[model samples]
Target: MKTLDLLRLKRRQLTTLGAAVSLAAALLPGTLHAADAASAPEPADPHQWLEEVLGEKPLAWVKERNEASFKVLKARPEFEPLRQDLLGVLNARDRIPGVSRMGGFLYNLWQDEQHKRGLWRRTTLAEYRKAEPAWETVLDLDALGAAEGESWVFHGAQCLGPSYRRCMVNLSRGGSDAQVSREFDTVSKQFIKGGFELPEAKSQLTWLDENTLFVGTDFGPGSLTDSGYPRVIKQWKRGTPLSAAMTVFEGEAKDVAASVVVDRTPGHHRVFFQRALDFYSSSSFFLQGGKLVKLEIPDDVESGFWGPWMLLKPRNDWQVGGSTYKSGTLLITDLKAYQRGERKFKVLFQPTATRSLASYNLTRSHVLLSVIDQVASKLEEWDFSKPQAPRHREVKAPFPGALHLASLYDSELPRDELADRYVLYYTDFLTPDTLFLSRAGSDERQVLKSRQAQFDATGMRAEQRFATSKDGTRVPYFVIWPKGATADGSNPTLLYGYGGFEVSLQPGYSGGRGRAWLGRGGVYVLANIRGGGEFGPAWHQAAIKANKQRSYEDFIAVAEDLIAAKITSPRHLGIMGGSNGGLLMGATFTQRPELFNAVVCQVPLLDMRRFHKLLAGASWMAEYGNPDDAKDWDVIRQYSPYHNVSKDKTYPKVFFTTSTRDDRVHPGHARKMVARMTELGHEVYYYENTEGGHGGAADNEQRATLQALEYSYLWQQLGR
Candidate 1:
């Protein structure tokens, strides 16, 4: 599932196997708590108690573990310095105030030392273009939270289309997925009396009109999926109570989720019901004349509307009206005509072996697409209003760093009056983020803002290189290292990766990494492995389910290449990843224990066999096959890190981190993994923050402390 706001948080090279030392003497006996080994096929998880998220016993366990880990890392001299440096970067007032165009005004949320909770404000477009825009405060979260005695964190808002005078403001307590939404009048700068409001739950709502709302929230029993997301959607009228709202759609309890999207584009004001059957599969239906008419398309194909046309992006090859559209092809068709049984389509973009559609945004009369060619970004604009077939033109923003484009289209404006404008964001390993405003079809671009450099990147250099995986696939990766660095394999290097969920890891500036690691003369590597969307859906599908091993193999290839190139050795090399990448780190730690000296696994899913049984893990069954199935288990068991951790293996000094407030991926995965390793005679460090959701940290200070501890651990373990 996509987060609602920002801050959301390879060639085979064989390495010698490290000799296994006697761990039985070093480990504490009977540390496994209590579980009958003969009760089940594999022993029942002895540390299952940790799964009870707010339980007193589990919290005590978390506190003890956190204190122990904190004491060791805090004792390091670099800890305090790292914390201060990161906190400074995070709280810098010079950072760019990113804006969103709404109601003919640019809205922005500012947070710093003065306003830690942030201030949501807006300014006129002309004023925003100036060096010092005069911002009018719409809401001060710090003040509101203090007045209400709540830890209210802004989750964002859904403003009514056209006028945008009314909005539903989403606020989360301590940065959790669950949020409390309240309707407010932007023009009046106050909560709307008797307006639509929803209590704390993993909920979402969108504006259907000034007084109508299409919402998906917890509506009592049997209204939520096993993933803890809403399974039912209701259409609530202005004067009616939410409890009496009309039920528009309902999904099964086993379904991943059910959400509604209301398109407000001129001539395409339609409401659509989206039922997510699994992580990557969904069925879409648009409301027409009081009926939910299901879209006649493959379940795996992603369907959406752009202006007056329906955009279809298929994950698998689809044959419609005897025409076979290749996978990864972006097909567009007239929305009204298609609904009336027309099977014709216009190809906006097609996939190649090296080129794929990264993403697409819409201008008033044009379609702007950001394409990835060999893991680099390129832009193109299509004018579909032409009498003949749509003509495509290149909209170039040439740069070494990754460039992402977002179109500035307001449905309230007419096509002729709309400006051909889009927002451009660019960044790399060393370069700070630069925001630009440019015309979509033309090259008339102006620098809107540039982030101040958070670290001294004078000697750092970024280079894109390829590593051949075991299957002979050329996987690309980016490495940032100091100039004049030697190839003697003495420099400390940290390789990071995430190979699942179609999420691409692009080259972006990281102040924490720059100050803590790069400034200390270290190499940083980002692997664009299979299962990531660096090359689009095809790249991701290549390493999913039964073929998930491809991702693990691809990661190992990059690690071996780093060592082979003599950039860093096993003694100095380290690895880190969170969420899905945490699974990657776990597999690497257990499967190739001799490859590195340090591993940082954060908020990860280590117990693959039981992953689906956890909180939101059931939603990802499509990404990783159901482990309960015997055939799938046979393949999954081969790489299940929790099951693979052996008492006899020589493992690296690993650091595991998690959060008690992570209602998405259960923190039990990390807790249980660490417990098993320790019980098996390996000492590991762990820290479970009490607050923060899946992103792992609530505010800037919490983020700073977490980064300091991690970098300190890496320096202590990898740096010589």
Candidate 2:
């Protein structure tokens, strides 16, 4: 046998032996809560009672857990300091006020310690260029919430454009996904007494014209998908009841979601409809002559129009015009020509082994592409007005970090003064955020604002490292080391990872993270493992569903690599992740309990078998296979953390956090896991915030508190 193959075989045998020993211990006698990994799975979930989201019993349980966690975390000496420091970052007024260009004004939603709920306001371009531009408040969320006795969170507004005089403003109670939408007059600065309004539910709204709207919302029963998102779209005219609105399109209940976006770019006004078949797959359609015509593109490809050019980004390879465009390639074609049955496409951005299209933003005549080269970011602009097709130009920006570009151009309003201008937000691990304004396709950029450094990085450094996984795939991760840190394995290390949903974890400045962790002599590591889009769709695709174990293995490889490098031993290592990454934390800690001393699992999907049944969980079946399917369950059960929790095995003292208002991932995931672990005699810390939806916080104070609690947990566990 080949040497590499021989080595792999021996490694697998050793791993199997270790797993067998763990499995034997898992089957030991214990109070049954969640199903044991080695035992025949329980037909009914014992802790399923916790899934009662707002039930009296569930809230009481959540309260007790929160109190217990607070008593421990709040007692830490570092907790208050961390909270105050992080809160200052959150409430800083000098932080760049990100704006959206509309109606000859730059609009922003400003939030601080004073205006914790947020203040929607606007400023002229000339004023915005000044150090402290004067702002005219469009809506005061704190005032509105107080007036209405509601926890109103600004969900954004969809304004009718060309002349953005009127808008449909959306507000949610406590930052939930479901929102209450109402029409308002921008000039009058008041909610229209008899204008369009929608009751709370996940909804999408786009103005078709001054008198009409295309809305996808919960009409009633059967109007929502199994994932709890809009499944039916309708056209509602002005001065008409919502019930009287005519149905335009209806997607299946099994579908993930349905949404619509109407572009009113002068003569190029168009309506785009999207049906999310699954999390990573969707079909696009455009309304033509009052009929919905499906856009001829792959289901997994994102289709959109920028000026006269139609952009198509495929998540998988596309074979067209006698050529195969690789996955993650950005292709553009004339919108009218493509609609008239032409297949020719010009490649705007192509992915290489080291380069992938991270994202793109559209101006009137250009599309700025954020290209990721080996996890570093660069910008490129493609001008569509070129005769030979859109001419590509490199947009000069700071490198070796994340470059976030947003166009000030109002595509819906073609006659715009800011049509050619865009905003660039740049940041790195040790650098504070700097916002710049530049004309599209040109290097004439001007610094608009820059934030003060949040933490001392005098002797701190950030570097990338790669570790080989069990399958021989090399995984990349970044480490931010503090001053005087050495290879003695004595420093406390906090490693974070999120390896799912094609979401690429890039280097970005987080003031709260920096102040709470790095500023206090803690080393921070970010793992860019499989199941993330750091390399492209292939990177994410290689670690999903039946291959999901690959992500867990990659994370383990990174942890093992850190230990081998003597950066930190298991005693001082703490790992954290949220949402999909929360599942990563659960599986990793359960699979290799001795790898670390602390695990922070936030809003996790623990019970894979019942994940699909949870709110919004059905949409993620594309990433994680349907556990109800016996064949899929066979592979999933191997990594299902809730099912794999062992009674006799030693485990890290895991800190689990979730929100009672989290309508996306059920709080029960955290609740059941904690309950099961506690029942199995494993002491664990649990915290369930009362508000903040899936984010676990409603406002800045809540955000700071949660962050402080987490840092305190890390210090208590890893500081030793």
Candidate 3:
């Protein structure tokens, strides 16, 4: 018999058996007595229900189920196909080449021909003897003998001398709390003596001059207990002893980095110090002669929420660079004045609603800005040469499905010589990322390079639709369908979303989800629910704290819309989300159990009552109110999934997965929920990986295995 037929048969048999058992109990004199048959008070301890149904050791039963499921999934040929797709996507960019200029030489970083590892090499402009030519390697990463996993070595190199002849190489081991060893070099080939070693340092190094360098040191008496916020920034001079490092400028700012840009006039340098707090609220100051002078306004600025600073440059009188905070709002700030206790800033260009600023750069005379309008998924370029009256010229959106701002590179040529020429790189959900050069005064853009040309994106379709929530609120969702799919809407649908924390779930390339899920006769949907930044900050604030349940209701509305629209039936519907999104999955599953056939909950914060007590949970109290407060508890208790699991109600088959190394959201949340569900006579499959922090699986291989298991569970529950 087919899988669906078998499932139907099993369900019918189970129903008949349950009815027979009930009939037999009714006929028994003592068993049917009012006292014996009184509806048992709801399980006082919900967790006890798991022991009652799945035997005394609930976790052991979960382990056995997971192992059996893993075996069944691993043996399937379909599982191997997804694994192969994952490998292909990860290795697709293996030999790609990229070009840049540094240290008076044209530099190239590409995958080595022999070992297929990334290598950095440089060649002088005089050696090449061409105005514009292909770059060659001068200093390969393999020759440096840097240990494996230290791929960020390129970012550690900085030029020291005025002639751009000498370079300082700082090598870092491990991420975050890295041990940095600095080696001075006059030439790119070798390192000089008398190097300094920084132990247990989590800060990045910035060169002040040949002898003077800025090293950041964290100060808190000892280590900080809060993981969400950044460590305090304290500056130390290069020659200072490790024990005697002095505090130059210390505030609420966490990690700080400095950059020096030569003024258009010779012999003048504009040094900028960019500091961030809690990975947000980044501000930059222009330092002249080792003294803080002016503050450079980031090209994209709205509020202090702007972060992930890409670059800083003194553009004429204004400083320009890309700045993103929150998610949607991108602004170009023109620094008017910067002095102690007095600062003036102005927005050069701001994209309106439903549009997000992607890239902004200033040439000598004109400013170039890229904006992605979410309404149409279109890319537009605005010319702000005439700041008083900027003109927007719509450029073709880079990709059809979804367009993303990848990177921007300022031309090496003189400002006047290059005129209006600039490079723009963009990618999309289905399209391979590509780079193109656009010259001022010309509409024609030339392709510089493409990251993925072999991968075909011919038939992918992305469409936006709105679903009405229980409160009559409209939630937007993006749906991806396979090429050549019939409109009959019989395809299996996988709806994924995370609707909290002002995070906009923008559509972008997802090789794994695209090839493994959508490519295999399935539909993928991303719901832009209320808690996300799709609309604006207000959208997120609306669904936070007491209104958190709105996000869950919004997710259910999308799923129900998919079913009602015939996109997929309940039997073929699967929902998957992680972290905050994982909360959405738990609430949705418990509140509307029959709406989905399968759910993939990863590192979920399900135990709402005690979430604040867990790692990184205290910081989120702003988003999810503190349950300790009686008023907050009243609202939290209404939708806390762990507290609402009903013993009498049947729930959909759920696969709860978490990692032991997930210090952000405690693994106990998943464990306790699974235990509680099982005790309530609900079937649940649980998998707890031992590593990978809050993300769960560590290595790519482990990630692939876990993803395969998740998809397999969905197939077993929904595809049946």
Candidate 4:
């Protein structure tokens, strides 16, 4: 599940901690207020002590809870087999070796039983296309970790443009967001001696060239945001003391963060300074002749440049050049003209009540658009051969599943050049992922690879169904079940959701979920509720702050829809979510305890009252209203799982999962909530992995084990 957070990891990685940096020269009105100081005096939260993440008492409490939960979950009859089966799927060598385009090579990070920490290897484009390519290992993470005596997780590397040999390799100690970045020479396959390096912190570094970097980190006092992210961007040169680096930009302490991003598209090597004012909004600036020039655009808009076009995807309505563009509109203008005060925009895509743009990528002469109509995938390729206007053509997908497109490996051409080749990945609840290579000017698409099905899906079928929500709005959901399964209200069904941050919940291949749940005749449901990009910004904005309960209500509507259709009863129904979705689960089970039999809330933010005071929580105030605001708290406290828990209410046995090393959402949210619930005499199980970050697993083994534990708990509770 996608969380509203960003981290220092490669963009290709499936997970992120939160949004990128936000900076400001001065504090906005009320931005510097203490998050912990409520508008009114508040009663002490008895379990508050658990918020001390690494404190002795909390560790002891965590250990005790882990042992207790282990006795219950591990004792399940299916736990061992489920774990072993998942392990086999995870360790399978036949899985797709996802490639990254860097320099002149196609790079991949592979992990298996033999190399749990993974191996950073690369190959030529031709060799990568051929089966069983000859790969050159550049970094062996397992060996490096062993040699350094640290559980080093490879965050990723930012290589210099063009030649792309020198890079800043980010390494996390035990899967935390704080990581140490070291300069490495890809050609030599070794760390560069006397090269640039940044010690561990939630940091960001972009290469201005090989010898200089735009750095943002915890640089001494007052250099970090309240969210524990870098608040200053500095220009650091090689062979100089970090303290001597010139501060180029500074952000407000209350702002999320500020960092520099260099568009490494060769000739289009533009440097940008971004200030994430909050989780979903930011102001961006482009460096021109050593001066920071603010881009004339809304802070809520997402802007980028491809070729000669300046692109804008606005989350709010914008009025420019006598045209009022609606929210969720994608507009384009000539970059030179835009800089010269030409506000006229070419409308590329617009969202309807039922359709919204999920993602878009620029090719050499076209823009590949991935739009979701009612949560179903729709592909469109717009040819911008003529800069004045572009001709659009819809590319029909070969199969019925969620389709995602990416450029071919090593296609890092500049904006002026074409990135005509792309790889399309399509999959759903039952279908294994299949990859296809498509060229901009070609009609024929080549099948590049297909993942082997981890579980037999011979009789399984996926159906899209809608349910009426509390506000009488229709909510869509996908249910994957056996073809012959009847709506007898007896099937053990698992419902998942992540209804925040405009993140669309699209269908994808999940071998672990398929094998652990569906292979056992269990049903899986993905709810496309409000507060998501399923229908775009309007859909998400409909459930923010005071309206946040709408998302929970929408989720309940889907749950009730399943029960009303006789698909599953509350006694047989379960729910799972992480990060913001974790908040969804907590709110749901608390507000409507009778609706679900089990819940797997992982790396969640439960204690809304103090969430802002926690690591990275304050940054998300845009998505979730600040608790310090009494007006906002009035609504927040109404559904906050921690504040809403009651001793008199009977709650289902919930399994709380988190990572001690998670530097994003503090593990304290889970620990304190569980502690409070247990104190209130509720049935709850807890497990805190010592390593995994916000995603809750550092590697596949931990991932499989965690999945096993979750599935085991669900089955044991639902009587599957």
Better model by lDDT: candidate 3 vs candidate 4: 4
Pick by lDDT: 2 or 3, better one = 2
What TM-score quantifies how close candidate 3 is to the native fold?
0.70
**lDDT (Cα, 0-100) at 64 in candidate 3:** 73
Q: Give the TM-score of candidate 4.
A: 0.94
TM-scores across all candidates?
0.93, 0.94, 0.70, 0.94
Which predicted model would earn the best lDDT? 2
**Residue 389, candidate 4: alpha-carbon lDDT:** 64
RMSD of 3: 12.0
> Residue 417: error of model 3 in Å?
7.4
Clash count (model 1, backbone only): 4
What is candidate 1's lDDT per residue for 675-706, written digit by digit as tens? Answer: 78888899899998877777777778888998
Candidate RMSDs in order: 5.4, 7.2, 12.0, 5.0
lDDT of candidate 1 vs native? 0.80
Clashing residue pairs in all predictions, respectively, total: 4, 0, 12, 16
lDDT scores of the candidates, listed in order: 0.80, 0.83, 0.56, 0.81
lDDT of 2 at 404: 85
